[model samples]
Every structure is written in structure tokens, then in C-alpha cells.
Target: MYYQVVKRLFCIAALTCSGMYAQAQHTAVKEPKDVPAEWSKAYAPFRMAGDLYYVGTADLAVYLITTKAGNILINTGLAGSLPMIKRNIEALGFKFKDTKILLTMQAHYDHMGAMAAIQKMTGAKFMVDEKEEDVVKSGGATDYAIGGGVSTYQPVKIDRLLHNGDTIHLGDMNLVMLHHPGHTQGSCSFLFDTRDSSRSYRVLLANMPTIVTEKHFHEVHEYPGIAKDYAYTLQSLSGLQFDVWAAAHASQFDLAEKHHPGDAYNPAVFKDRAGFDKELAELKAKYEQKMAEEE
Candidate 1:
């Protein structure tokens, strides 16, 4: 059964790779139409909790975590928003030169589109799970390139390969990596301590699975037994020692009003002990129930 699940996930990853890239390649040929209100030319970046920043986009969330050495970026915004991401980062009282690490939550086009651009701009090393390195280096697995509106991205060299339970260090910040396989074989979350003086931990889950149509799932190659695995991953992550949460997409669990900006109410409030326990319980029940339904 485990092998079946793993095989299913691998196949799905390949299909999603193709589908993702096709969209990016096509989308890159045209000027983005119908930009969102938050992404409007004059919109400003709002603060979330800690050092994380959300410039506002349905596709990707731009996070900046402050380390004693330098700030770390969680994920780059979508392909069409690279310039804005750069501008927003600059507006936040920091320069790209201060960015030391660029972490990809997963290899999906939307999450990684601006990776190459950000790396060039900031000279930060890129990190992804070793399992997905081949998929990423081969021009991406999900077939999409979210690397800013830029047509081409130099393949990102992996400076570090994160494994489950491995904690990544950035001066004062310690980001623990969790390899949750259901979203993508290599999908991961950067779990770390918040900047609060009290020093609580927080998790930035990358792309939480949405129960879109099966075609949508198949396009991304939803794995066969992954429904159960994803549930388990959530259950495991819920046990970790963090009280803050963020993701590449800002849509889950209402971490804040409008957006998760540092200046906004600290999203860490959701990561508190009570909230974390509640969220994990709810997520476990939700996904477990969904898996039974599929059975």
C-alpha cells in the first residue's frame, strides 16, 4: 500500500509538472490581465506576524524572516509579480543583499517562479528537499515556471537538501524542515521560532491541498494513497513546538484580516498552543473523514 501511494504520488508529480509549466510558458507571452486589487500598482505590503511579510496575492505569499545574520525569504510570489516583490522587499526597510536563504515550500510553478530572480537579486542559497531536486533541476516538475514574469530562470542550485525533522539555522532563527509528501513528494514546510521575545515556534505550511475537482488533482497528479499520507503529515506537524503558521498561499484558516503582513495582527496568535492543538485536531479529522469518503 505504501509503495502504491508512493508510485501514485510520483506519477502525479510528473503530470502536475507538465501542466504547471504549460501555463507559465503561455502566460509569460502576454501581459497579465485583470490584476487583483491588492496587487494593484499602488498597493503596499502589510506586516503579518514576526518578520514575515505578505505583499498579497492569491497564488504566492512572500515572507521575510529576520535572522541575526540576515533575513530569509520563504517563497517568491508568482511569475507576474517579481518586480513588485522586489519593490515590496525594498520598501520593507531591507535590501535583497540582506537576504541569506531562499526556501521553496514545493516545486510548483507558483511557489518557485521568482526563485531564480530572487537568488540573482539577493545572492541567497536555495533550499528544497533532496527528493525533489531532480524534478526542480530538470526545469521544474509541475511544468510551470512561476519565476516572475521573466521568461527564463536559471536552474536553481540546491545549497541544502532538507529532510524531515531537520532544523535549518539562520543566525538567531532556527527553521525546522518537515517533508510532507502528499502535496508533492518533496513538498515541505519551514517550521521555526517566531521573533517574539517569548520565543514561540511557528510553521509555514506551503500549499495545503484544496479539494478541487479530480481533473485539477490529476493535472497536478494527485497521488492515489496520498490522501491518507497528507492527513498523517498534518497530524505530525501539529505535534511540533510552534505557535505561528504561514504558507505560500495566504488563504487557509484566516491567519489575518485581508492579509498576513507583519504590521497586521500577528498571525502567530493562531500558532499558540490552544490554536495549534485545535487546528491539528480539526485538520486530522477533516482529512481522515475525507479519506474514508474516498474509500
Candidate 2:
């Protein structure tokens, strides 16, 4: 009888210890509060291909996918960028009021700062991955990337919650969502088909698999499995097939080199298989190096 009582006590003690460890692992990490100035600069909107348009800023990326039914707007840039995005969309001969849906690659302040404002202005339904819904609803306050830092923006409502492999259809266009977490819990990549004058091209709206935290793996309380998630995201990104790819940031796609000042619309420049491969390799290398360092 005494042996059984002692065993029960041990089991309860072990369970209590496990619960304490989990609570500790979920403690928020600190984050920087400054918003980069360059992320707000507006750029001219241009047609990427077919009905797809680049309506984002010089550094931040926003894409407008237009169709007869309505339009889909992706990435809203910083809070100060709403007017620029509205103007850019108008410049492309698209009406902001016609936007039916709003989406984002991640819920970072830089990427989603103007989302709430845009949604309010256009009355568009905001869609996001289930994991990111809380982050979006709280602006940047609840984000794992934000930790307990002072990063935040206007809170936006999530109208639709998405999952991996789910399809978002607007008019004749269909965008396949690829859940590539780690950058943010709900960082997503999109794949779809678009056409230019004579040919159809598979386009990938890539969500980069870059690590943002300076915290070591074990030290990341807000996002405990961030390193593992990044590994999975990198692997998922490498296997994706697309004729042309653009990322969350314009710099990731060599936007300046491909579409310079007064340069004619040439989608061919974005079809660099070698560049994509190099980027993937470099990202993977960085992830590995970070992991080693943390170890």
C-alpha cells in the first residue's frame, strides 16, 4: 500500500513538473519596436502578368489579382501606405471598392500595417490562416515574432480562416495556399497560373523561409518549435514548382534589376531558375548555420 502511494505521488510530481516546463516555454520573448522607414515608400503599380498587378511600395510587396467577379488584394504594407496602395490600384485602372478579399503573407507589422485600414476603406473580407488569426486580430501584439515587444498596428478582423492546400477562388482565378510557417505562425505562400500575351505561366507568391529572431531555439518561448518550423518551411519551398516566383519583399525577386525605371514589361526576367535555386540554397544554409550556432 505504501509503495503504490509513493508511485502515485511520483506520477503527480512528474506531471506538475511537465506542466511547469510547458508554461515556461510559452513565456513571451522581447522584440524591437522600431518600424523601418523604407517599408512605406510608394512605387508605381505595374502589371506583373495577365490580370495580376504589383500595387505595393518600393520595398514592401502588395499584389492585386483582378477578375470579373471582384479583386483580391495581398499585403497592405505599413500603416502610412494605405493612400499609396489605393492610388497604385487606381493607377492600374482598378477600383479599391471592387476589392472583394484581402490577404497577407504574414501578420508582421511591416506586411499587415495597413490591412485594417484597407479593409475598412474597401469593406473587403479579410482572410488568413487559422494560426495567424489571433495575431492579425491583435495587430502585432499577440504575434510570436512580436513576443512582448511594442510592435503593433490596427487590429483587423479575419473573415475567412485558411488551411494548407486550401483554394481561394475569385472569379476565374484560383490561388492555392501553401502554409509555410516559422516566419510567422501563419506565413503562407501562394501558387497560381497567369498568362501574358501568348503563354501561361505558373506564378508563385513565395513567403520566404527566413528566421527573424535573435533568440536561440531553446530560448524562444513565444515560438518553441520555430527552428523546426523553419526547417519544414524551407523543405516545402524547395519542392514547389513554378515558372515565375515573387516573394513577400520585392528585393527577394530582384525587382529593380528586372523592372528598372521606364523598363518595358518583361516577365521573362523573373524566370531565373538558377536564382531561385541559389536563394533556396542560401536560405537553407542560413537556417542550418543558425541552428548550429544556437546548439
Candidate 3:
């Protein structure tokens, strides 16, 4: 039953049941044409919470965490996202070059596109989960799920390796890494605390473990533990406790429904524990539906 569930998820969209029982090949995928234009669409950066800011595009989400020592930037959006990100940070009255650390939510092109350039410009150290270090360094060439013998984005060197439960401290800020694999082998979420005038809030920057493979898990020889990893990620996400939450993509967290451009600073808008649970359940149901359909 568990292997059946794993088969259902590992490559839910890869092939039909009759076509299962083969390993996933490291093949090349063509550039997709239907990519959302909103991915690169400029969004007015605004304060999300105490010292935390949203500097990404309308779809892709980039975050900035400020501290006395330096700032931490998460997710770089696209290869051309630097201009917008820089403007967003400077617009918030923060220096763009002051970024001391570069973090990633996932290793996909949309999230990691500008990492190399940004790291070069800011001279910030690029830290990634050890499990994903090779993929990032190979610039997606080593991505078993993505399955391309080519690089999707510019390669960047890793300065440090992060393991599950490691706390990254810079000045007074402490952000903990939660290994939530599946979307990518090393896909992860972040848990941290931030405060404003009202009170302190426990914030979760979730990676939203999405299964992106096109081959069956039993066949995906590149990532042997994908099935177990996805199970762990789902279970881990279900048990997490967070006062407020956001996801790697704005759409995942209903950013529009929560806040609009020029909206005043308020962290309460993100306090949607019920919504988070619903989203998680919906994702589960989606996979379950796919599983049933395939069967």
C-alpha cells in the first residue's frame, strides 16, 4: 500500500500505470511557453512584518530580513530579477549591497535565477542544504527531477552547507531550517520569529513541497528516496506550528487577498493557520485524486 502511494506520487504525471516500472532517465526538457508572465511582473515591495520585507515580483516571492549586522535575502526570482529586487530593497530604504546572506526556498530556476549575480554583486555567502549543493553548483544540470543535461540558471558556489534543524544566526536574527523535501531533494522551509509594535509573531516561510517529476518514483533512479522524502515532508508540514505563514509563491499564500500595494504594515494579515491547513489538505487531496485516477 505504501509503495502504491509512492508510485502514485513519485511521478504522478509522468506516465500511466501500464507505463510504470522503468527508471527515470536524465533527459532534457524543453523550455515551457506557458510560464506565467506575472513571474517577472514587478510588484511594489512592502513591509511584511518587523524587519521583514517582500521584494519579489507579483508571482515569485523574494524576502528580505534585516538585522543590525546585515540583511538576508531569500529567493532571487529570475535571472533579470536583480533590478526589481534592488529597487524594492532600496525603495524600502535599505541598501541592496548590504545583503550578507543569500538563501533559497527551492532550487528551481524561478527561485534561483539571480543567485549567482546577486552573490557576486553583494559579496554574500551562498548557503544551501548539503543534499542540494551539487544541483545548485551544477546550475540545475544535476536536477534529477528537472531532468535536463543543461543548466537552467547560472551556477553559484556554496559557502556553507545546511542540515535539517540548523539555526542560522546573524546578529539578533535566528532563522531555523526545516528540511521539507520532494519539490526538490533538498527543498526546505524556514521558521523564525519577528516582532512589530503590536506583538511578536512566529513566521513560517514554507517551500510548499510540490512534486515536479514527470516519471514514476519507482522509476526515478536519480532520486531513490523521493517517495520517503515526500512522505516525511507532508507529515512534517502537518505538524508544524506557526502563528503566521507564507509560501515560496505568492499565489500559494493568497498574497492578493491578504494585502495590496501600499497597504499598511500589518503581520496579522498573514495569521492564517486555518488557511494553511486547508492548503495543505488541498494539496494532499490533489495527489490522492491523481492516485485514484491513475488506478
Candidate 4:
């Protein structure tokens, strides 16, 4: 009886320790090294522009951009993160009526999870790629490319279907759309040029890389053609000049590293055109080599 009692106590202790560990992980923040601790709240917020705010969620980030032309937003995180996003925007002293265009790169639920709600709330125009419109309307699934793998995502509609090389203007911003299809059939990106106080214009590239997640979050399978398209997509994009590159999960790489006081990664790592070319060449070489071996 004493042996059984001791065993029971040990089991209970083990379970308790495990529970604590799990809870800690659940609340942990997964962001670049520069992310501040205060940004670890359930729905932490960041400022991107004078009147624009951003919020980071588990797998996505939402931006609230306001302009004289109208209010524009980019990327809405997960469905559950909407309330916090709304609250964050409200705290910035703007009502939902102020939002105009609700633009997203793709139809991944995390990127567009709050689209329906935001559209309903602000009556904003949600724009997406024409190829992505069907997928969204059909409520189909997509393979988000992340690194070499893919993850699943739910479908959603794009109120305004966009095409490659199309320019959409908002206030003083002229955003050019680029169709980057390695991540999804309709995976696209946005580009815009901003003039600094020095009167020099710089381009901003908001890339939507193919996203892949672990099995726990894997909700869809990859499309067979995604790998082929990703290579072509990146190569085609190399010609564009962008001073900054931002994405959903990661921020502008340069900004992220710069923001981290002690981070080893430097934005200079990607600054060299030759070095960037070499990396791309190597990636394509590896892919070709693997394909050759299979053949």
C-alpha cells in the first residue's frame, strides 16, 4: 500500500511539472530577438506610422494605416486575434469607419482571418489576387510555403481581385502589386516608394513567403507546382529594387536585427547584391541537383 501511495505522489508531481511547462510555452513569444518583453502581451501592439499601428499575434501581424485619402490596413492575423486588433486600433483613437482599404497578400486564414469581421465592421474593400479569389470563394485550402515545407490554410474572398503589375493608390502612397506565386497560387506582394526627409525615394517590399508550420498547425497540403513556381518567383523578383523587406511573421530583416541590441544577425547580411545572387543560385542549384538525382 505504501509503494502504491508513493508511486501515486510521483505521478502527480510529474503531471504538475508538465502542466506548468506547457502553460509557459503557450504564453511564450516567438519573434525576432529585438522584440521587447512588453510586446509579449496576448495582443501586443506596435506603431508603424504617425497614425498607423500594428499588432502581432501568434502567427500573423495586423497593420492599421490611416491616411488623408482613407484608412488602409494590411494583414489581419488569426480569427481569435481580431478582438485584440480592434481594441488596439480603437486605442489609437480611430473608429472603424475610418478604415478604407483592407488589403492582404494572400488568402491564408491567419492573414485574412479577420477580413470578414473587418469588412463587416468598416465596410472596407478587401483586395486579393484574381487567382486567389476562386480559392477564397470556394472555401478551399492552400499550402503556405515556409522554408522548404508547406502548411494548410483556410480560404477567403477578395473583395477586389488584383492582378500582377497593377498599381493601387491610396492618398500619397502608390502601391504596386506583384504576383509572387511560390507560396500559393495567388501569393502576391506589395511595393511602394516613400520619400524620406532627405528627399530620397526608397522602395518597400512586403513579401509573403511560402509558410510552413509544424504538424500541430499543419491544416493543408502543398500544391505540386509550388516548388517550381517559388524558384521562378524569387528570380523574377530579384530585378526589383527594395530598400526594405517585410513579411507577416518576420519584420523588415534589417529593422529586426537593428532593433536587437545584441543580435548576431545583421541586415548587412542581405545588403550585397552579389551575395544575394549567390544564395539564390545555390538554392536553384540544389533544387536542380535533387531533381536530377530523382530522374
TM-score of each: 0.69, 0.86, 0.87, 0.64
| lDDT of candidate 4 over 132-176, digit per residue (tens) | 775555333323333222222333435678899988777876778
Task: Kindly list the per-residue Cα lDDT of model 3 for residues 85-161, writing each as its tens digit.
Answer: 99999999999999999999888888998898899899999988888888887778789876377777777878999
TM value for model 1: 0.69
lDDT of each: 0.62, 0.83, 0.85, 0.58
Q: Put down candidate 1 lDDT per residue, 229-280, tens digits, no spaces.
A: 5766776665555555655565454544444333445554555455445555
For model 2, the superposed segments whose C-alpha errors exceed 4 Å read 1-35, 147-151
lDDT of 1 at 41: 34
> How do all the candidates rank in terms of TM-score, highest first?
3, 2, 1, 4
* Model 4 regions more than 4 Å off: 1-44, 49-53, 142-157, 195-201, 211-224, 251-256, 260-295
Pitting candidate 1 against candidate 3, the one with the higher TM-score is: 3
TM-score computed on alpha carbons, candidate 3: 0.87
> Candidate 2, residues 1-295: lDDT per residue as tens digits?
9999999999999999999766543433233347555577667888887777898888899999998999999998887788999999988787889999999999887788788778878899999988898777656777765535444676787789999999999989999999999888899999999886789989999998777756777787888888888999999888988888888998887887788655677778788777888888989888888888877
Model 3 misplaced stretches (Cα beyond 4 Å): 1-34, 290-295
Candidate order, lDDT descending: 3, 2, 1, 4
